[model samples]
Target: MALNYDEIVGKFDKYIFNTYTRQPVAIKKACGAVVTDVNGKEYIDCVAGIAVNNVGHCHPAVVEAIKRQAEQLIHVSNLYYTEQQALLAEQLVNLTEMDRVFFCNSGAEAVEGALKLARKATGKKEFIAAEHAFHGRTRGALSVTHKEKYRKPFEPLAPAVFVPYDDADAIREAITEDTAGVILEAIQGEAGVIIPSDGYMKEVREICDETGTLLIVDEVQTGFGRTGKWFAREHSGIKPDIMTLAKAMGGGFPMGAMLAREDVAANFGRGDHASTFGGNALSCAAALANIEVIKKEKLVARSNEFGAYLMKKLKNLNKDYVKEIRGKGLMVGMELSIKCEDIVGKARERGVLLNCTSDSTLRFVPPLSITKEQLDRTVEVLDGI
Candidate 1:
């Protein structure tokens, strides 16, 4: 039987929480860089599951890996080990040059783990995060996340100080003896893809070193070739004490990880932190295959190449309302003088799915596998709008 969009929506309205402001279209299926709605209308997915499907949606390799693993060992408690877990951990370490990893289930969970690890490792209570930074929504993650609306109701979160992003001086001033770590996103996703200055991260790293504070890079959205490099940290040439990963890590499968230097990771001894489903056989298999697909397709280099192409096309639009176009690699944002919510609707009508961030910036985080022709179509839709 065919899915009825109205029925699905009615069920959601009756049973689901009224939390998200979701797009009107109901996606039924996706392949590569396109998603088909229940009505069979296809949209070139510029959103790419909000930058999760980096290897493109439903990659055959990832699907096969998940299916094979599920048949044998879908899961087992963390008390025991699995080959899938071991292999995925080694691969994550190799890719990021991090010493150890703790797996979880989502970006927020990864942030929770990273924050916990930082506090435990440093034996401090306060964290320094940037203004406009969107770390996560959990209490611990929210304590560091900087948004009045999201934080107002959930007051009295864990101790944290908000500083101006990309401002090393402000960070230096904000740090105190109680500061356990400084958390930042290499490219601010929810704050409209705000990319820091070239030396910003390097400067922050030096400051953390001088102050003996842990530097935690939240790469939840920027990791896995989203920013051209395997990780956005590569662009800065700095190694953080702790890092968080998710979104694209499992090629759409739910998975997250908190990685750290060996010295910092050691602080999280047995019984310190654990996720029941973290690093389970199924998720690990999916992640291992996801990494393999990223390597085999050379998607990292492709992202760099195609991101330039998309940026050039967007630049040629020549609209006075355009405020700024900035990003690294595939994680690009077009900030507008006016709110872009309506523009997202317009693009959707024209068969190109778009997402507006921070209310005014149209974020373009397409799959690394998106074709140049599809990119042209997406830009053309914007031109028409």
Candidate 2:
């Protein structure tokens, strides 16, 4: 049975929630950094499923692990002890400084868990987050997210204060007795891949230490070697009390987790929090395989090298519309003076799939497995535009 793109689109219009303004092409399959649409057209995938396919689409090891686990045990719930879940938690704790992990289903759930953990541990009511920082869309996550448009419709969100990003002084001024936690994205992803100034994270760490405020860093989009480092916060040489992760954690499987220091994690007692399908065997197995692939392949170093190459090629273009080129590792963004929606459409026509964020910023989050040659070809396409 041949699939019909038009029929699928029509069905989506009729049945799916009107949450996303989707791209015209319907992806049928992907491998490495290339995706084939239902019509059999291939495009160099720069979006990488919005940074979810860090190890690349259908990585053999990850697929094998998922298959093996699925055949044995896919779901036994969190109520029972699963070796896969326990091993995945151990792998996560080994990779990070955090002492414990709470698994969930998405980045939003991880942020939600972190918020609840912070409030419970510190016994405080308010949280301080940076302007332009995007955490997630759930109620607690939405409250800390700085964008007004996303937060406007759902008014009366959880109590939170917003400060200018990278402003150490403003953070100092904002922190008070009521502040339970200071949440921030090490590099602002949804807000145009904004990177903070040198010493900004260090200063924030000091402030949190002095004020008894828990620092929670959201690594949902930047983790799993998407950045040069294992975690973006490692670039600053500072550790947050809690870190939220998801995007690349379970390969292509839906998964999220909040890693916290021992004392903070201990705040939650038995039956404090649990997700029915949070740490299922399949997701855990896939995650373990994902981590193994990243470590064994040394994708972190590759991201740094290829990311620099891509940035250099982009900067050399010196396009009139290019306002700035900023980002860390493969998570680069080219901010343009004009609206970039048209440019994105043009790129898609040229067989290069790109994404636009914050209206004018062209986001590039290609798979860590993308080749230098593929990236060079992508640059050639952009050069023509």
Candidate 3:
């Protein structure tokens, strides 16, 4: 028998927290860049679970890894060591300049870990973050996030100073003896895919160095080859003292991590911080497969090539409603003078799924495995809208 969609919706309304203004459709299954609703209508997915499905939905290798690992082991907790966890940590350390890693279960947890490390390492009580930046919803993370609407309801957050994004001088001015570190997203995904100016990251690195402040880069949404690189900081030619990662790390499973320089990471003692389910056998195995797929498939280069194609095609449309098109790799955004919520609904009706962030920016974060033909179809639908 078919599932009762209305009954399920009613149950959700009755029991689930009213947090998200959910889309009308109910997704039942997904493959590659396409998702099917309960009624069997298919749509090209451009959100990619908000950049979590970097290897694409239900990737065979990741699925196999999960199944195999599940059959053998799932969670042993942080009380014991697992080879899967150690291997994943080694891979991350080798991929970047960081020397140590801390496993967590979500982007917020990773950010929270990084913040705690910063405070402990620097012995400072304050932090500096960028305006229009989003870290996470946890208390420590929320203290650094810039949006007033999200921060207002929960006032008197942890002490943090805000600086204008992409402005090196403002960061320098904001730093003080009490400031523990400076945290910002390399590419602000929630702020509508906002890309920083050239040399901005490098300048921030220099400022942090001069002021004895740790530089923390949040790559939760822009990592795992989503930006055509292992991490977006590569594009800026700078290595942060610490990096927060999640979203796509576990290839659809829940996982997160914080990589830090050796000296700074040593600030955390054995009992300082930990998670019960973090670095479990299953999530680590899935993450390993996800990284392998990105490497074997060479999806990083593909993201760059196809992303340029997408931007070029979107520019050619020359739609009057579009004010600007910007992004790197598969993380593209179309900013409009008018609100884009209606455009998102219209595009969904036309069999394309798009996300509108910040009210007027239409965000597109398609899977790295998406084909050019699929992109062409998306553009054709947008043209009609």
TM-scores of the models, in the order given: 0.99, 0.99, 0.99
Q: Model 2 over residues 1-385: C-alpha lDDT tens digits?
A: 8668999899999999999989999989999999999999999999999999988999999999999998999998877999998999999998888899999999999999999999999899999999988998999999999888899999999999999998989999998889999999999999999999989999999999998999999999999888799999999999999999999999889999999999899999998888999999999999999999999989999899989999999999998889999978899999999999998898999999999999999999999999998999899998888
**Distance from true position, residue 347, model 2, in Å?**
0.6
lDDT of each: 0.95, 0.94, 0.94
In model 3, pairs of residues that clash are none
- For model 3, the local distance difference test gives 0.94
Candidate 1 deviation (Cα RMSD): 0.7
Position 224, candidate 3: lDDT: 88
What residue pairs clash in candidate 1, if any at all?
Answer: none
- On lDDT, the leading prediction is 1
Q: Regarding lDDT, does 1 or 3 come out ahead? A: 1
C-alpha RMSD of each candidate structure in angstroms: 0.7, 0.7, 0.8
How many residue pairs in model 3 have overlapping backbones?
A: 0
| Candidate closer to the true structure by lDDT (higher is better), 1 or 2 | 1
Kindly give the number of clashing pairs for every candidate.
Answer: 0, 0, 0
